[model samples]
Target: MPVKIRLQRHGKKGKPFYWIVAADVRAKRDGRYLEKLGVYNPNTNPATIELNLDGAVDWLQNGAQPTDTARAILSYKGAMYKNHLIGGIRKGALTQEQADEKFNAWVAQKEGQVQGKVQSLAEAQAAAEAKAFEAEKAVNEARIAANAPVVEDAVEDAGETPASEEE
Candidate 1:
């Protein structure tokens, strides 16, 4: 049986969550799988992916063909890159320790980038909230100012009417 690495649909409609799996090509999309590798959630900002790096690389090396989207996901999570490094190791261009060190450095860099994006998104949301508050404050001040003169005029009229009656 030819094996393929593919995504299995899971979550509710319009909010797709997927399971990355290694399965026989003839198996149903969400049906029997050789191994459950990980998950992908696209609803969240930056799209969330939890993958087993080693498992995915093992499948790739064993000739599991990935679908287009699955390939992108695997590439993003570094399985494809790790497989390449392992290939280099096989050809004597890189040692196992060196390949592992390179993979670790890449993972650390990817994590830093993701964290940076999250931080920027949070800062932008805070700025928008602050701008909205300031606009509301300005509107309230204008309303109070517009009403103040009417209140003063009403008080003066009341004072004049009573004094004129007494006179």
Candidate 2:
């Protein structure tokens, strides 16, 4: 039986979340699946993907073709790269230790990149909030300044003697 790795849509109307599954090629888009491999949440800023790397690679090795979007998700999560390394090891082009080291290094690098993006986003949000606060402060200060002279003039016109004059 021809098998396929695909995404099954599951979230609400506007926000879409997906389940990565291995299913028969003839199965409906969101129907029966042999196994659910992971989840893909695109609602987040970085498009969070939680995948079972081993399961995905196992399906790939067993000749399960991935849909285009599923392929991209697998690639993003390093399943494809891990599979490639496994292929190299099988062909005697690299040792298992070397392949593992490379994969680990790649995962570490990818994690660093994701962290950097998250940090930058937080910094940008803080800067925007600070700018807004400063603008609001300036507006309030201007309003108080504008009202100051008018208040003083009214006090004088109402024949209100200064405390020093009353003394």
Q: Candidates' lDDT values, in order? A: 0.95, 0.96
Error of 2 at 48 (Å): 1.2
Tens digit per residue, CA lDDT, model 2, 35-64 = 999999999988899999999999999999
Off by over 4 Å in 1: none
Candidate 1: global Cα-lDDT?
A: 0.95
lDDT by residue (42-129, candidate 1, tens digit) is 9998899999988999999999999999999998989999999999999999999999999999999988999999999999999999
Q: Estimate the Cα RMSD of every predicted model relative to the unseen true structure.
A: 1.7, 2.7
Query: What TM-score do all the candidates reach, one by one?
Result: 0.90, 0.91
Model 2 TM-score on a 0 to 1 scale:
0.91
lDDT of model 2 at residue 40? 98
